[model samples]
Target: MSLTLSKKASEVKPSSTLAITAKANELKAKGIDVVGFGAGEPDFNTPDNINQAAIKAINEGFTKYTPASGIEELKKAVCKKFKEFNHIEYNTNQVVISNGGKHSLTNIFTAILNPLDEVIIPAPYWLSYPEIVRLSNGVPVFIKGGKEQGYKVSAKQIEEACTDKTKALVLNTPNNPTGMVYLREELEAIAEVVIRKDIYVVADEMYENLIYGDKEHVSIASLNDEIYKRTITCSGVAKSYAMTGWRIGYTGSSVEIAKLMGSVQSHQTSNPNSIAQKATVEALLGNQDTIATMKEEFNKRREYMYDRVCNMPLLHTLEPEGAFYQFIDVSEVLEKEYKGSKIQTTEKLGAILIEDFNVAVIPCADFGFENHIRLSYAISIEKIKKGLDRIEDFLNQLK
Candidate 1:
């Protein structure tokens, strides 16, 4: 007998970055020197102090189940985090912890969405936003933002995407794939629309501490008390503290919304990892000097990689103000053929890069942009240079 998947399950697409990562691993297994730029994660290991906290938790026999919404200790830490960095206020009852930033977002959407609800997603967004919305039986409205506007989808575009059916909008500042960090004014403008429409705002501040330059990220929750009341502000220790594998993320918002997410998380995943929760306390409360150092390193590498890619043949790059990726435009190379393959799209460019140059980058089609590739600068300066050199050599010979 044949089995069928549920319509909800069938609606989701595989993660595009993971596809490139899988091929990179395949080539690596075959003894190829594949340099994967497809990773959306930081290359740095979790800080030693955070690791020790986890060890301490385990040794102290603190391995039992935590509350569905997270332990009071960790929830308190999350509350402290918003107070420290964002200057917003929250209580333990208003926060829920999940496996990661994505998991937190999933909980938020699953708890609120009814079938066919509309979700507005600015394009060149994280790969999972549209899929998550669709999986929740909601319709995704895409607002395309290319290199023309700092890759930022404007408030006018967002206003057009809204309708009575619009239930929520996903905002990923220091965004994945494109690294477009929305400024305070930009977020306030969007917040105005959301407040007037009385729609929920899902704020994904996963890359909260990765901002470079003179830029500052202001939470939409801070725009006004009403926005704060309606916004589900999600953040994780993953990007900011380099604790990606720890699998602990959290959100702060209205008590009602938090209660709903807690209910969803209770049955779905139960509590988050217990040891990770203890470790996350240290990560959130510990000295953030390491974050500054990491950002400095990132800034240096970002500038270096930007210059190197700009000098590369057939590559057009935009300077991303935050996050570690350089979304290079490769539309000029379309229609060019190599090794019996006509490079007609970003997908072709990706497949060829993995197969030939052993360099893996996520194609823009995943992020709803068809003419670009996302390259992460989270690796070492030397590695970034090496990968760019290899990419340049391959593209130069693409004729």
Candidate 2:
């Protein structure tokens, strides 16, 4: 009598950040001056040269389909990129280009994960890791890290979590929520366990060029030869070059993994947009001075926000050595009353801040950390300072 939708479509939860964005928009449309710190994107625009390249491609009728894996030129650019940045060797055949960093990860997860295979993810990770693993029919296992250890899981925890069913592990340096970049020494320890356990590692370096303070972003695959053989290096121009709308990301792995991903790409979405490919080639080979300028701006904002938030009495904020986020532990302010509403969860904290103070930040519960909330410093310094001033006032009242 009626058609039904697949269970896969129904099982997916609405994306966490998107929900926050919608609510923020609803408030903003009603003339509220809300400072949004929820989105994980740079506030910069795509570089002019890259944008021109896309225009040139479109004018020249470069609007057709590409190989499912990617165009040869784009793959070659990716090959040159790995050699230059990470000191890893890759041929064109070893790379596959997809829609965005998210799509690239989903492709990698789908290509490799068999049903019931376990994927080991570090806690306080990207919101999509566990979701993608589950969507691919893989079991997601998490190992938690705390502020005491600079928000990093140890080799012991990783080794303890592994079993015969373990298939893949995700390693995100200068990680999304915490912005904790793994030191080379720390990565070497994890890599040792990984190489011994014969588990595949997905090295997510989406924020590779955005380090600040004294921290350095290390590519885990570059540490050792054995780990390189089993690593899928994923990244995009989105975070680094402010090309989020370009929807181009690439991955480098063994030829076998690349080809299998190609198969997945063919059946699901075929090739990515040809214009994005041409634009990405320009981005990869063009002068990188723009990236340096953006990094400098982000660093200034990061330090300013870090110093201010870390000094708040009721909040415990760790200074992230890299990335533009400050993950603030907010357990001290969790009481039964915030504007007369019971404030128990970080979601409630965020909601109260939105309703009363007109600020938008992500509650940390969705990132597998219950006692925290993430504030992004990607906005202008004036807005950041003003928002913090408002938040500080609200927290003082709670105390």
Candidate 3:
């Protein structure tokens, strides 16, 4: 018999962020002194309280198959979180806990999208959005948000992108890669568009707790009853509580959508990890000071990285308002020659940096921008300084 594979699975692209991080790790394993800037998780360990919660659960033999949706306690905690943090009121029945934020998104798209339905995703988006949409048999429609706009799409742009087949719009605040947060007015306008178009809004607030400066995270679903009815709000303890490995994410939506996602999750991966669920409960309701500390440290790193990149010749980046990434525009650098050959692309520049400069950076082609690269500050300040110095050295050598 000829070898065969699922066409849908074959068509999906691997996550560039993970691939770059893996390569950086591989080099480190080989004893190379690589200063990596590709990490997406916090450098800090999970809080001791959260860890203790997991240990306590294990000691109590809390490991077992939970309800396909999640534990009632976790669901109630998520509902409380939504009420207090996001200003959105959702009951336990409206929530579904999954393996991770990505899994929550997968369940969402699976529950809501019919074949060929369109999901309007802004450009320079989290690289996984388009792939996940495609995997769920939904088409991804992109609208670009240029550098001048702080990498955020306007309500007008979103309104223009919609069609009769539009099923949803992805709104990621404290966005990955760009670190830009949408303003309240901006979200209000977008919410109006979402309602007028009568489409679902997938509010991905994974980095909600990581916003820097005076900017605050505002969930579009909280704006009004109409948009709330049409929105599915997703969040997790990964970024906020430094629990990426815990694999716990939850969402709030209508009871109908929640049931569908739960039913789909039942066969896919019954409940999130039992211990992780217990830990997540503590993460949501515990001390909460750790998040503020992590945010402060991340702000310091963000300022340092932004200043360094701004001073580097032929490199440009907007001051990131939130999250822990600096989305650098490397177009000028790519146009220049390094080692007597034109760099030409973000991938080539990244490869040269890793091979010669002993630095790892994520090239952003898969993120819908060919001339940009994302540098994450989710590492120690010392490592960040080293990586920036190498990047500056590389740029200085570009003729």
Candidate 4:
């Protein structure tokens, strides 16, 4: 008899973003001059204050396990951050700290979803939402927010997509891939629908502190009492503090849901890194000036990348309002020929670029868009210019 693996695990797709980044690194190791735009993290080093806190923790012998959920200090800091930043009140017990934003999401779905439940996710999403829901034994129902809608879904569309099995909806503002933000009016409308439908909201606000321009980052949970009760607001120190390697993400939710997530995490992974937790406390409550500095730099790169992409023939992108990605509409380029071969999909285009043009890009098929690609502007201006130049050269060659 042949041995069998878990069918559920076997069906899962590896993250394309990570795959492309890995491929680029592999080529670079071979001394190839690859201009990569596949990174999802800031190129900046972690702040000195945060790093000092971690060193202090180690010096103080604070490496032992605290609690399954988290230490008291970090939880209080998370609650304080929620109150001060998100304008949402949460007690320490109502907050849970996990390994990262992804872990927090996994915990949310595991705690909330039963078998066969449905999670409504906006299309052109982070590419992990559906997989997480499926791994939790839930269904992922997509609602596409087209280019016409600024890559954002309306409350009416969400309501239309709902059914009795609909358990929750994932709302990612200052969203990934497209980098568009939801206004207060839009959140209010969506909150009304969420209240009417009696569904949970998984609010992923990892990029909250990274928002730019006049747009404010409004947490949907902070909108009203009803939505607050239903929301599992998730965030972390990864994007804002340049602490991706620290692996500290947290969530603010109701006491019952928080307890459930904590219980699940107690068995699954015991606790997040103790030193990282100490560092995250500093990240949340320490000097916040680094965030503003980072945001300013990102805004400049965003403008430069947007202008360059807009000028490139057969390619166009919405000026990213927040986050660090520019979602390019490459459908026109896909319809054209590249070196006498039909460039049918963004995947093919990506391969041609990496193999021939020495550039790495993330095709958006895994992001629920077949004719688009996502380019992250989280690197330096020099690298961004170089990569964009290579991309333009490729576009110019399309027949």
1 versus 3: better TM-score goes to:
3
The CA lDDT of each predicted structure is 0.87, 0.89, 0.92, 0.94
- Cα distance off (Å), candidate 4, residue 306: 0.6
Q: How do the residues 2-21 of candidate 4 rate in per-residue lDDT, one tens digit apiece?
A: 99999999999998888778
Better of 3 and 4 by lDDT: 4
Collision count for each candidate, in order: 0, 1, 0, 0
Q: Of 1 and 2, which scores higher on lDDT?
A: 2
What alpha-carbon RMSD in Å does predicted model 4 have with respect to the real structure?
0.8
Which 10-residue span in candidate 4 carries the lowest summed lDDT?
16-25
Which portions of model 3 show Cα errors greater than 4 Å?
none
Candidate topping lDDT: 4
Candidate numbers, best TM-score first, in rank order: 4, 3, 2, 1
TM-score of model number 1 = 0.97
Query: Which residue pairs overlap in candidate 4's backbone?
Result: none
- In terms of lDDT, model 4 sits at 0.94
- Model 2 bad stretches (over 4 Å): 1-3, 340-342
lDDT of 4 at 188: 98
Q: Under the 3 Å rule for N, CA and C atoms, how many clashes does model 1 have?
A: 0
